[model samples]
Target: MITIVPVETKKQRAAFIDFPHDLYANDPNYVPELFLGQEDLLNPNKHPFYKHSSAQPFLAYKDGELVGRVAAIYNTNHNAFNKVNEGQFGFFDCINDQEVADKLLQTAEEWVKAKGANNIVGPINLTTNDTCGLLVEGFERPPMAMMPYNFPYYLDLISHAGFAKKVDLRAYLVNKAGANQRSVLLLDKLEARLERSGIKLRQINLKDFKSEAEKIKKVYNKAWDKNLGFVPMTDEEFYYVAKDLKMIVDPKYCIVAEKDNEVIGFALGIPNINEILINIKRGRLLPTGIFKLLFGKKNIRSIRVLMLGVLDNYRKLGIEACLYGRIIKNAMPSGILEAECSWMLDHNYLMNHAIEQINADLYKRYRLYEKAI
Candidate 1:
């Protein structure tokens, strides 16, 4: 018999967090999320997301053995912003059993239904602002930092369970050795042209990070406001994330486009720390694991250009090329072998074309699924 259990106690929560570690043990490309980080994300008191939204995690068991897990999420901010009644399912994992997958999704669906959601959409862990989407393509390599991964069977499982593709997200790969240097070569001229219009490019200032982040936050929200399912981050939420990224951020790859000292655009590229975390057993940062993370920084050879945005009015100003070019130029000297510009909406042609201009290959694809109740 299959039993669906709400993760109420600490032990149940731990099991919910650790289930994927066991499920993916035999998969070489599986990368375990950090235990503490996962814990905080699910914790209402620790994560700012819970301040305005609520999510309940459920675990599925077959004959008393854990087989699947999912989280039912109702984001008040999302509904209020998008003007829709939609719930999300995220942090999903399961074995190859169809029955287990069905039960896990059903539990999430029912929970959100009780919260008055008429439509369900996801694999959206918390929100679009966080790690969201299911890997539908590119199963050959392990995922980069803050990206999601899943087994091939998940596609069939979700489809059989009545979910259909809502949208596809794209990830592009640019290797230093093969990347076209047109962006780098034309970077100076582009910036010079932008300068004539009072816009200039520069790296982020680590010393004034607090003020800088606040300014960039405005640009981030404005630049991405029109994106599908996009919700502006609250002050606490932005700082909560910014504080964490601060530890791994390199000033060289974090550049901004400014006009009279006002940040109109910015790009942030973080080290692919998954290189080190993949080796840390069960994502535990303890004993030997912490040492691996502390000492592994110098060995990392790649980055994820996770955020690159320009204000709507600033579009078509060659700001995008300048930002990307600056990152590529800076990365060359740092021995960064490759970079992944990721999670772009499949339909974003303008931005996609900009990345393609630098010879980035579309290597991976992820999807979001939705079903109307």
Candidate 2:
């Protein structure tokens, strides 16, 4: 017999976070999420998302053994911004059994329905800004930082639950050996043309990071507004994420475009920390894991261009190509083997074209699903 329970206690939440570690112990492609990070993400008081919306996590047990888990989310901000009453399910993990997947997902659906949601969409871990989607393709290696990994059977399991494709997100892989360097070759000329127009590209100043972050946060909220499911992040939420990412930021990959010293465009690439986290036992950071994470930076050979955006008034100035070029050029000399410019909306032609110009291979694809309640 199987039963579903809400995660209300600290121990249950710990189990909710740890279940994937045990389930994926033998899977080489699985990387453990940092324990503290996941804890804070689920905590209302710690994460600013709770300031605007709410979420509830559930665990499925069969004969008293943990079998699966999922979170039912009611994103008030998303609903208000998108003008749709849809709930989300995220942080989903389950065994191979159809029964387990069905029960876990069903629990999420019912929970959301009770919250007055008329539709449901997910495997978004929290929001589209976080780890969203089920890995429908590209399972050859471990996931890059902040991307997700899952069994291929997840495709069928989710479909079996009456969910259908909402949209597919793409990840492009660019290797140093395979990338077209024309962008780098032309960067000087591009800069000169932009310089004539008062736009300049430069590395982010770590010394003034707080101020820089404040400027970029505004650009971030406005830049992606037209994209599907985008909701402007609250000031506190942006600050919360910026604070966490500050520790792992590499100046070389965090580039900005300025018009007379005012930031109007920016690009952020993070070292693929999953390479290190993959080796950290169960994502714990005490006793030994912290040492591995601290010392593993030099060994990482890949990066993820997780975000690249230009203000509406600044889009056509070739700044986007220059940002991608600068990051690619910087990565080549750093012994970086590969980079992924990822999670682009399938229909985002302008951004996709920019990535394609640099010869990035279309490697991985992920999907978000939705169903009417």
Angstrom error at residue 204, model 1: 0.7
Task: Please give, for residues 21-113, the per-residue lDDT of candidate 2 as tens digits.
Answer: 988989999999999999999988789999889999999999999989999999999999999999999998988889989988988999899
> Which runs in model 1 stand beyond 4 Å of their true positions?
none
Cα lDDT computed for each candidate against the true fold = 0.94, 0.93
Best by lDDT: 1
TM-score for each of the candidates: 0.99, 0.98
Cand. 1 Cα-lDDT? 0.94
Report the number of clashing residue pairs per model.
0, 0
Every candidate's CA RMSD = 0.7, 0.9
